[model samples]
Target: MRLWAASVAICMAQAAHACETALLLTIDVSNSIDVAEYRLQVDGLADALLDAEITDVIVQGQSALAVVQWSGVDRQELSIPWTQLRSRTDVQTFAAQARAMPRAFVLSDTAPAEALDFALRQFADAPACDRRVIDVSGDGTPNSGSDPRPMVRAAERAGVTVNGIAIESMGLAITNFYRREIITRDGFVITARQHRDYPRAIREKLLRELSRILG
Candidate 1:
């Protein structure tokens, strides 16, 4: 009797998670970013949602989203717990929380691979998500962790699309590495070519990934 009850509970849990479209937003803040630029990225969180094209896709009670911040091999933090984006109110609240977030992890090195690993681990026990993806934004190549390519494959094997947003800084080499390394369905990287253009980059990038996914 107890085994049957447990099976029913598992099935219901799976049903709930099946309705989730979990997106992990990974923000880069390692040696590449200064204080001002960090604020720019954080401030743009609201724009990612309230922007016209983005709002067109937010079906109430359908999408569940979360955020993960990564810098060094050991530096990874969860900015917002997973929540259902059911209304405009939810987006506003998430933006406020992210903007007001105090840095919980230190910036030591750029471990893009570790970021990918952390994101995968976060989904381990969660309900099964339909469109589970990791959006990794960065300015340069991996300097201090496992190679990102292998982790990219791991993500693909797990059915998580790994999309990228490469910052086109004056000194970096990974201009559009996302295009070369990531290969999930509809997975592509957008380049801003300048940190000053982060807002436009974030808005355009999110619209491409998070909008009309159902249509």
Candidate 2:
């Protein structure tokens, strides 16, 4: 009986290390986003992860999460290293780290394509998962770097899904831009009417995306 109990514990520990999905949350820190707006983005994500529903899914699914801050063509930083959430405590710890994450780039151009490319490359170091997704949130369209369409195609070929959250102020122009150029065929884009709306939108987006993985 003792031997059987020990074997079961080892199996459970190994299973806990297997990630069901890998999620890379990328934030845009371009010149268009002021310091206050940057705070909203990071804080919003930190809060979103702590949501009951989001936390449940993350813990249950053993999801791997990472954060990337992106700006110009050559400016991108992995603000948070990949961390797998095996329990609610793990999720809470990651949320705290996210809230305290320092700004990676500022006064730089918006380069979604380069950002996407950079994000895709990081998966090489992440724990192997059945599904991979990149969640990109930005206030404006790309102004520098190569066209994003090709990069979107590259993501598709690599079996990675690219989703977007458009933080728009006056119109749906950014939303439309994201749909047309950023998200993959199997992915989606959520619109935050304004920077202040990011928390709600990000929560909604995470629920949808993670639920899909769970389903």
lDDT of each: 0.74, 0.92
Native-referenced Cα lDDT, model 2: 0.92
Over 114-178, each residue of candidate 2 has an lDDT whose tens digit, in order, gives: 99999999999999987899999999988899899999999999999988899999989999999
Q: Candidate 1, residue 159: CA error in Å? A: 0.4
Q: Which stretches of candidate 2 lie over 4 Å from their true place?
A: 1-13, 213-215
User: Which structure among the candidates has the greatest TM-score?
Assistant: 2
lDDT of 1 by residue, 135-178 (tens): 88877777798877888888878878877778886644575566
In model 1, state the lDDT of residue 62. 52
Q: What range of 10 consecutive residues in model 1 has the weakest lDDT sum?
A: 53-62
